[model samples]
Target: MSKIRGMRRYGFLASSIGVTCAAGLALVPGVLAGAAAAAAPAAPATTAGAAPATGPVTGPAAVPGSTQSLPLAPRAAGRTRGRAVGAALEQGLRRADVRHFSLVGVVWDNPATELHGSVQIRTRSAATGTWSDWQDVDTHNTDHGADPGTAERTGGHIRGATAPLWVGDSDGVDLRVRADTGDRTDDTAAEPPVPLPSGLRLELVDPGDTPGEDGPQTDQPRTGDLSEAATAASAANSGLAPLGATEIPALDRADTERELLDLRGDELTDAQRAEPHIGARPRIVTRRGWGADESLRSPGFVYTKKAKAAFVHHTATGNNYRCSQTPSVIRSIYRYHVKSMGWRDIGYNFLVDKCGTVYEGRAGGVAKAVLGAHTMGFNSNSVGIAVIGTYSRSKPSSAAVKAVARLAAWKLGLYGMNPRGKTYLKSGGGNLYGKGKNVHLNVISGHRDGFATDCPGRKLYAKLGTIRSTAARYQGR
Candidate 1:
């Protein structure tokens, strides 16, 4: 008679079956004789009167309609209704503010009696304060039914409803039950609980608004405006046609009568017959004076009275003695430039050979000359011209760079200079010439800006921008 007086006599006969089943059928046999006199068992009745136990003892039954009692064995009333349905699903997953979760297994549905499962939650990122990890799930309640009969009615109603199978990085686990009375318990279920595991109902999402395919995309162009628009679309598709001052070529009269009949006499000298003569004198003498034993007659041409332009120098040496190949090897380089560098005959005012011949140096006409070496504080109103050899490491021939670009566009249109805003020498120090100063020659330059060596190296100073774009397409700019 005791199991707490048989659960208070089946909780007062289930509170009098709604007032004795509303007084009918003679009050159901006086409410089964007042539930058999309230489970009559005056203590001494273990064996002497075991027959006294009647209604209240329907094999530990009571809940036909309520004050919960049924626990004699449907596996101890499914382990007391799985610990009151796992304490009402851990108080409804702690009122649904679920924490890091994972369950993944539960699904009852016995034809829509519903009970779902499957968890994988991850929260805790109040703005990247970090947490989220193992995500992936299913059974989020498509009317919760067959997932092994909702994990055997959530392991017979829920108490530690057999969860743990989330294999990685182990966390607070414990669920993996099959218990529909097959009793198995690893128990540890109480903290902040609830019926959560239903893919923990997703909602936090914002790892920078998550859409990934590995992120970032846009930026690339400046290599100097893509090499100046590929050098102005390769100089407007280069078929080359622009120089128009009526295409200026003329000057031949039999090569100026065989270059003034190879300048008559003891191979000339006397400062090569005192300079002056230019274009029509191909027996070329090109003098360099003032050192035949010094004496340009006392500062005779010390920078020819402060010259203003002309500073070109290019004899990167190497002459394999073919001195223009022969006329007695060009008179032994005209007596080794009138006896060894002590000039007076070859300080170039024009030389160009490797077969694009144009010799007469230190002469005059190429807009008047005055040979005083090439550049160095504007070598006496300059006029150097030399193309004897060593174009830094070979590259002249295209008919000797187009006959030195047609004698530097006909001597920069006979020196009214301004080959694109001049300015030549640059190791600092200002104007000895004009436009951007320091030896401006209005056209050609190089010899490493007037000496201190490397005479025209990087392959003819990389063709000085194609000889200043062929003297700016022959000054038509």
Candidate 2:
């Protein structure tokens, strides 16, 4: 079977990041404020109306890595009144040229609110200056985030969002959001069209220039001494890589076992130390390699006691990126998740591109149990691995799936977890499980296995069993 839409194309220019919130549909420089301050509540908007279909929030020369947030308003096309559609209105942004952004998503106020509608975008390729056909953006992506009551979720800044689409470096975009009209239980009255969420804003993200392409390499990321925050982030991974190493090089099985013994230290018993069953460490591009603007994340790192399970996810940002431009896609998401969604950092622990290149996600060391906001209720004691594109209607590449298997085998093996086995993860409270519930789950589970929503998608989820078997083999089980 072929994908409903073949590999989508997304390219972007990373320059400067911007700030955005539910209340204020404005994009400011990411460097203008601290993460905490950036996440602070925004003053309420005095009025409710769509912003003019202006292109970028700023001028043509937007802050390098940029985000163009435009509010959506009702359009006259396809709208109906008089019970059949209940004053139904279509919200959209007419074709317009603005900034150089590669990724796009629609966001709205209220995390609990769902957009009962369709979101489609047609973009003009920045390189060719030709418009592509309209592409559907996943509307049910709220299921891919943090669970209820968590600080990340409870934070006043969080908002409901559609799955972002990676549309390559595009200077122009056209969007349409039409509400769904559900089947009526009875014919008594015409079913009113479902309402779109409040405060819908279209987000255009430019990942900015690739690190080495326009600036210093990751080994020496900047001209001057590194910032205190940047140093700390690098130092956290010092156990595995050099202080400023761009990547953690792959380690053979023997070295990996030695590394395991060294990393586990007092945690390992004499027997375990002698025969530390662990898989070889895969090469991982560090945050620096991907040009993560360290200051963009909240200060400090959060970690769980240890990783017990691995929850797989798809970024749902579409399949329109080449393996080479994956870094830009990640940087774009980093800015979007932090600056736009008001999170401390990007939500996943690790990101695997379609080509199987794994990038370190969330600042903490790759070996440590870095807490992630990826899976809502079951984040604790688990590692979140996000494959780079949407897998709902498409199949993940063989390399991507293999990378997940390799990552899970190594990470889970650190905590003595059996990839082919099962474990229990307490729900912080989610749609599927109640708080503190020790839910039995596979050592490697799809996001939807823990949450009720369709995550990791049906196609990707179907491969979980294969991934488990493969990982177990890698662990030499």
Candidate 3:
């Protein structure tokens, strides 16, 4: 079957399963792996003798003008049987009826708490005025791992989540959800019933798409005071142009030659310099290269000292879009992260489109250890590379797979790590391992390896062996 056709088929299969098994057999942590839990990271230390904050968990307020959250009250909820527990949109959110919203996600309760639920949605397609089949939202999400000292964990409006599935240029939406009490302890009926997720919310996100309206203007060149000829080239190199107009500029041969002149000031460590040479860096479209509107983000990029491992993931936005729509898809995600989720920026360190195009994500330089919100409990010393589509049952394009290998080889070699070898990452705090526990993992691993989620999907996760070999070859291992 053609790629698009396969994606639609997957969508149909997902929806069918969702309708039939919405409550009974929803996604469990062990479905992907055999419940081999990683150690959760250690909790934050208190100040001197101060008591820990043990108050009720609160959700962050909705982003101003970009998103609105509507409550979803339970319908015929039954705790004992787990049969009558489901929630639907209080009022149907038809795209035709509500013309303003562009994206949707189910939000609830505390960021630190886990939510077990199945969500299915059907959207109207703009290409044909027909409504598409209901598709299952990726519910086994473990992307909430934030750095211990970072604002994202202790500060931001974090909450329980499902991957936000996009419905493009559509006019209608129907959504249903069933919350499962994920506890599987078998000590009889002595315990209090696991609280049905309180404050179940549906977030309607508006992308604010328009010419010169989606985001603030890109920053001007830092070399603005240079000669006009120099400044013009610098502006283009720095991604000062508007979004969508970016063409992923080629690396300047002269610039590369000059950088080669300095071996002492290189970002690579002394040990890495002594190791077998990996090939030169791969072509990367920087944040400036993709025309990211820097003014939309909080200033000053954060960085870790070195990246010891790379975690792979799928964006989990369905595979309905063409390659030409990649940039637009990225832009929408950017707006969603910053505007709707109240994140500082897009969560991944980099994004790979199906066409093999690599776009820089986050504000930090490509060579730096820019912390990302991709893997739960393991963000500190790692890099997250997300392919831009779902691959639960369908195969990923070869180009996308090749891109992962190339990017992994380059980034891992920078830290003197072998793409196919194992490395240790200290957990910040997660279901897998306790905080501060050093966990050994493959140098390049799927999101599921470190967190308890079926991310990067089954098909793509299975290809990690091939990806590892290809990357090792690239590193001259």
lDDT of each: 0.31, 0.73, 0.58
Residue range 218-237, candidate 2, lDDT tens digits: 44323134455665566556
**What C-alpha lDDT does candidate 1 achieve relative to the native structure?**
0.31
Candidate 1: tens digits of C-alpha lDDT, residues 1-477: 001111111101111111111111111334534543343223211122112222211121111100111111111112333343342232111112323321122323132232233333332333344454644222212211111221212223222111111221112322221122212243465332224332111111111111112211112111121122122211111111110000112344233222222212223334323331222212222121100111111111111321233444455334332432322222222222322212233345566666665544432222233333344333434455656655656776555555565565544433334444564442222122232344433446664564444555567667766765665454344
* Candidates' RMSD to native: 53.1, 12.8, 15.9
Positional deviation of 205 in candidate 3, in angstroms? 3.8
Alpha carbon RMSD to native, model 1:
53.1
Flag the better candidate by TM-score, 1 or 2.
2
| Model 3, runs deviating above 4 Å | 1-70, 73-82, 85-95, 100-102, 126-128, 181-196, 206-276, 288-296
- Which candidate, 2 or 3, would have the higher lDDT against the true structure? 2
lDDT by residue (186-286, candidate 3, tens digit) is 53543433454556666665544421233222233122123322222222222212222223332332222222222112444444334443434556655
The model with the greater TM-score, 1 or 3, is 3
- True-structure lDDT of candidate 3: 0.58
Q: Which stretches of candidate 2 lie over 4 Å from their true place?
A: 1-63, 77-88, 183-191, 212-225
How much is 46 displaced in model 3, in angstroms? 45
Task: Please give each candidate's TM-score.
Answer: 0.18, 0.83, 0.70
Which residue window of length 10 is worst by lDDT in model 1? 61-70
